[model samples]
Target: MTRILQLTDLHVFSTPGATLKGIPTRECLEDVVGYIQANEHPFDHVVITGDHTHDEQRASYEAVRSILTPWHECLWQVPGNHDDRLLLRQVFPCRSEDGPGGTVNFVFPAGHWLCIGLDTHWPGEVAGVVEDQQLNWLQEILQQASQEDVALFMHHPPVSVGSVWMDAIGLNNRERLEEIIRADPRIRLVCCGHVHHEFQFRLHQADIVATPSTGIQFSPAGTSPQFADESPGYRVIELNEHAFTTRVHRLPVIKYHPAPDA
Candidate 1:
C-alpha cells in the first residue's frame, strides 16, 4: 500500500505571524506539521491541493517550503485561487515544465493508482475554470493509463457541496468536468480543497471529497460565508491494489478562533 498525506489552504503570509481572520496561519501550519511528526508515520507522497500562501510573495512560499522540508522530496502541488502559478513553480522547481505559461498540472503513479493533480486556478478570479484544453489533456493521460485506477487532486471541487456562497464561487464549468468523470471508470477518487471544510459527494462511481484547511475553518451551514471554530486538519489516504481508504486527522485542540465579523 501507498500512504499519502493531503494538506491544503495554508494561507501563510510573508511576515511570519500574520493572521487570516484571526487565526495565525503560519503558526497553525507549524502546529499541524508537529502533530503529524509526533503521531503519524511517514507518507509516500505529501500532496498540497493549493493555497500555499495568501500573499503570493516569495518569502511566504519560502516559509512554506521551510515548514514542509521533511516531505520536500515527495511533495506534489497544484495552485488554488489564492496562489500565483508562476511564483509557485519558481519556488518548487521540480513541477511540470509546461513552459512559463499555461496551467500547472501533474501526474504520477502510486501503487495501483495513477494520481493526477489538476490545475483549476483561474487568474484574477475567486472561482475556478477547467478549460477544454486541460480536460483534453486529462483524457489523453487517462487513455495512456488503461489499467491503473485513477485519483484526481485539485484545489476547487468539481461539484458543489450545497453552500450558497461557496457554490457561487465553485468550478464554473462543472457539468463539463462531470461528464468526463462519469464516462471514465478508472476514476475512483477525487480530492479537493478551497472549501475550507470537510465534505463528501458522489459523482457517478467516483467519490468526490473536500478537505479542511490547515489554518482557518469554514462553516457550510450558512448562505453567506461563516467561519467555524474548529481545529486544523489534514487527510490521510492509503491505496492498495484495487481499493483505498482515507480519513481526516485534526489537531488535538482548537488553538485559534475566527472573529465574528471575519
Candidate 2:
C-alpha cells in the first residue's frame, strides 16, 4: 500500500490576527503540522490540494512554506481558487509548469499506483475551471496509462458537495470533467480540497474525496454561515495497485481569541 496524506485549503495568513471568518487560520494550521509530526504513521508522499496562502501575500506564502517544510522531501501541490499560480511557483520552484502535462500533471511510479495531480484553479474567482489545454493533456496521459489504476488529486471537486456556500464556488465545468472521468474504470479514487471539511461522494465509478483545511472547519455538511465548531483536519490515504482507502482526522487547535463576546 502507498501511504499518502492530503491537507488542503490551509489559508495561511502572515498577519498575527488574520483569519478566514475568525478561524484563527495560522494557529490552527500549526496544529495540523503538530499532529503530523506527532503521529506514528509517516507518510510516503504528501499532497497539499490548494489555497496555500491567504490574500496572495508573501507572509502567507512564507507561513505555509514554513508549516509544511517537514514534508518537502516529497511534497506535491496544486493551485486552488484562492491561490495565485505564479506566486505558488515562486514559492515551490521544484514544481514544474510544463504547461498542462508538466508539473500539474504528475505521476508516482514508485508506489505501484498511478497517482495523477491536476490543476483546476482559475484566477479571480471562487469557482474552478479545467480548460481545454489541461483536459487534453489529462486525456493524453490517461490514454497512455490505460493499464494503470489512477488515484487523482486536484484543488476543486469536479462534483457538487452539499455545502451550498461552497457549491456555489465549486468546479464550474464538472460535467466536462465528468465526461472525461466517467468512462475510466481505471480511476480508483479522486481527492480534492476547498470545502474545508472531509467528505466522500461517488462520481461515476470513482471516489470523490475532499480533505479538510488546516485553518478551520465549517461544520461537517452544514449550510448557511457554512461551518460549525471544529478545529482543523486532513486526510490520510493508503493506496494499492487497484484500490485506495483513507480516513480524516481533526487535531486540536490553539485558540487565538476568547469566547466570542456573545
Candidate 1 structure quality by residue, lDDT tens digits, 85-170: 88898999896446223888888899789999999999999999898888888888888885569999999999988999999899
Worst 10 residues of 2 by lDDT: 253-262
Please give, for residues 77-135, the per-residue lDDT of candidate 2 as tens digits: 88887787777878887853555633354566535577788898887788888888788
Q: Which residue pairs collide, candidate 2?
A: 218-227, 218-228, 219-227, 219-228
Error of 2 at 153 (Å): 0.7
Candidates in order, TM-scores: namely: 0.97, 0.90
Question: 254, model 2: CA deviation in Å?
Answer: 7.8
Clashes of each: 0, 4
